[model samples]
Target: MALLSYPRRHPSIHLLILSAYALFLLPILDGLELGGDGLYREILRDETVLRLKELGKVIAFSDEEGVRFQTTFLGSAAVAVQDVLKLNSLEGTANALGEVRYSPESVGSYVEVHIEQGPVLEALHYPLAAELVLTLETLCKEPNKFLTYDEECGCFTEESLAGLVCTVGELLTWPSASNVIPGQVNFTVDIRAMDDKVRETIVTSFSRLVLQRCDDRLVDCAVEQKHAAAATPCDAELTSRLERATRSTISSMAAGVRRAGGETPVLMSGAGHDAMAMARLTKVGMLFVRCRGGVSHSPEESVMDDDVWAAGLALVNFIDQNAVDAAAATAAESDVASGFARPHWSQAAHQFGCNRAP
Candidate 1:
């Protein structure tokens, strides 16, 4: 829905599809009972699939977890789109939900633009980056061991947790009141890393250590995996193109500007995006714009006007470059098919200005 106005702005661009059903929002229930709840109703609708099948490439303005619908009420839980649809038997609702089925060739590639959502870009004073990576969320329950420290636990050691980032973003307790000791505690653990193997290893080690420590203390503990996603890397070719576009845009904006690392920065995103899911259907790439203090999902989250302009200009440059490359490739194929000698590598490079930076 974010790019719905793109077609109006750029008339040359064809077919900007909006998959509104992909929206994920907070769950709300009010005694509504419905049947037909399962995997059969969780897939993309036929209409959406047909629209996607028409595109050779997709350019998405991806936000974290699609568009988040927030609520002011405390203790409200987030729910998947499929679950929300199941509670209603409204007209056309059943037809819009189906079992999973998608062809890999429907779309050849995907590119997303998003916010950095972390402090790296702000700290370095850069406007944008080509990001790669994702996240896993888990719920851990223990009996009053929230503040307990165990020196012997390997999971608690710096050596075992190296290169891994873990955060307890949510917590819930029973008998929550002053002068009352909580009998049970539940907390959500979010773990992330650039490498899937390292992340998985850390998760396994940490869960095992938690269970063993709880057993030794004669208290009950359980680690339930609420959500998990393997690290998804951006396509190498697309990432290179995006980086070039970003560099070009920044240099053109300020000819004498100094870059923190003397080059366009590449970052690893610990947060998840819709691009991760799109990766299953086609190649994926991402561009991240700098946010104030690398903070997101909070009232303090902000982006500079110049950074926003840079991001938009970079995307335009990336798309234009892609079109040029595609046209060149098409011409070469046509020449070969018509029984004409193909252009030499050097000549082709010169014609496309491949030797020129960006």
Candidate 2:
């Protein structure tokens, strides 16, 4: 697997890095975490970690002992920061603050590259998408139902299980055997939406419906909220860079293939990502490569090499662009601090909907 490595040498004053050991790569690599975040983190570890550490990069792993050390450490740091900032939270603010302090040693931007998990890109004929919104996921589970099953015909019909309020999947019946009736059934429901209210309503309504089904069937049912995550918006500035980088990369890679016209489409991620967590501190940008048939989280999930190559180039471009933008901003700040007046700079900022100094 190729890694995106820029800045042959560490140029930033401080580089705070976060990595996770990949347990999700079991299918790809035996005993080695060589996929997902593990792959990218390993790339840095092999090519850049030691080299950048000498230059003052504080690299931290998200997990060490089945615990997200990154979040815990950052959370503690956030508490300290909150105390220093004289901010008190009556409803508990530890998690929020930790996400803020997780990357204190950084002076660079955050960028993530992922395959677009939906069919939007394929449908729109776009090679890449800059995600604007992230949808929240709410997982609910129904457990242990005593149901009658037909032995000869492999079918179990539960009349009371109809009229569900939300789409449910991963339904399993306990003691799944052809010889015996299933005494229990377990199922999971996954609900997602861009709006929090919608998600909440669905969850509530779905839970109520499950209870109604149980009551009507005279079957005892167990339901629980497995997991819930709120939506997080991508950073505007970082998202813009992502768009620019994707456009530049796509244009450069457009020689052989027919080009998809129009500005890179801004898409909403129906899936959650690590970016949602990192968004607590610095700005985060994401580049979504088009996947084959928009299939994801399954064996059918795939992407064309061109789209993958486009994504890689987009990432490299974004990194380079971020450095350039940082330098420009620093220069502009220096000029302003040194009392040098540049009317055109102010005019340019105004034209771009940026704040200008009086």
Candidate 3:
């Protein structure tokens, strides 16, 4: 891939969101801002929704590895996002911007966690809006709901999420804390997984955990739909990488273990992306430009030259040797697809099949 003079392999949302922000200048009169996604409700006449908090995990057990062996709580990130954006909180609107109905039992009390969005190109110099939201939402109380619940604690046990790890890679706990309304609230640790398979598994597990809270009823929490990217089948090289991920020590040490059901260990994210999304569809991978102390989703999100160069160097290494093979393979396939020019592996294109010709 021919990169610009900039070194970063992956562009940040903080940097790219400017295009989204520029839309605010349009004359729709209201909204037209990127950070103002909440305004989409007004633009579309959707009502605002309120955020409910009612779930948290009280560790039932932990192994020597210190991994939480059980889940005592669950909640919908969608609902929280809805509240944070104040999408449905608006009164008297016909349609709610973020309306959701679910057994409050499913997702326990609400606590804040980071929603990583915006461009990955931005540096880490600015305030991390995601973190700010994390700071704000965790402090929100459910008034009378979440603080009270009755259950036979000894009966419920959390299921291991071995299956979910297939789509994601790194799962981590941010035991970091923040103050929302100073002197009032703190935060809980978050376990984040980055592998596509692992992420899918985590999402599935989260759904089920909340479902259990629903006491066996159909719930309508906000769900993540597949991204509308130009998706195609996963490539052979990517398939091999996914297979290796399954055997990786990380997968073996997961909380729960399940047998694969002929599903690919890798998956494409509908939204959250990095090299993972690109890697799943093709041999394309991404290198993240930093978020200056992890800031994003605000106008002030940022990063630095050093970080961009680091990302670029990693990207260079990934393609340096594969470029020639890529082109040779393209040309070697006796029959090139209609008008497509066979590429040299050395090209190591960003397009991979993503921008394959129109």
Q: Highest lDDT: which candidate?
A: 1
Tens digits of lDDT, candidate 3, 1-358: 1111322222211100011001000001111124311222122111101000011111110011112222111112222222322332435333453443223333211111112233321322221111110101111111111111125663222332221122322333334345333322222323332233333444567657755865565533343432222222333452343233223311223232234442212222222222222222123222222343333434555444333322222222222223334446446675654333322323332322212221
Q: How accurate locally, in lDDT, is each candidate?
A: 0.50, 0.49, 0.25
Q: Which ten residues in a row have the lowest lDDT in candidate 1?
A: 71-80
Clashing pairs in 1: 118-294
lDDT by residue for model 1 (130-235), tens: 8655443222211112222235663444443344568887799888877889898899787865556567777898899999999999989999985667777788
The TM-score obtained by model 2 is 0.59
Candidates ranked by TM-score: 1, 2, 3
TM-score of each: 0.62, 0.59, 0.27
Error of 3 at 70 (Å): 35
- Model 2 stretches astray by more than 4 angstroms: 1-108, 136-167, 254-260, 332-358
Lowest lDDT 10-mer window, candidate 3? 17-26
- What are the per-residue Cα lDDT tens digits for candidate 2 across 1-358? 2222344221111123322200000001111122222232334233322332322234232221112221222222231243322232224455654553534344344555666766667877777888787654222211112223445765434432321124565778879998988999898787766556556766887789989999999989888886566777888987898898777666665253344556888876666555555555556666777776665444555677556555545554554454455456557666553432222322222332222111
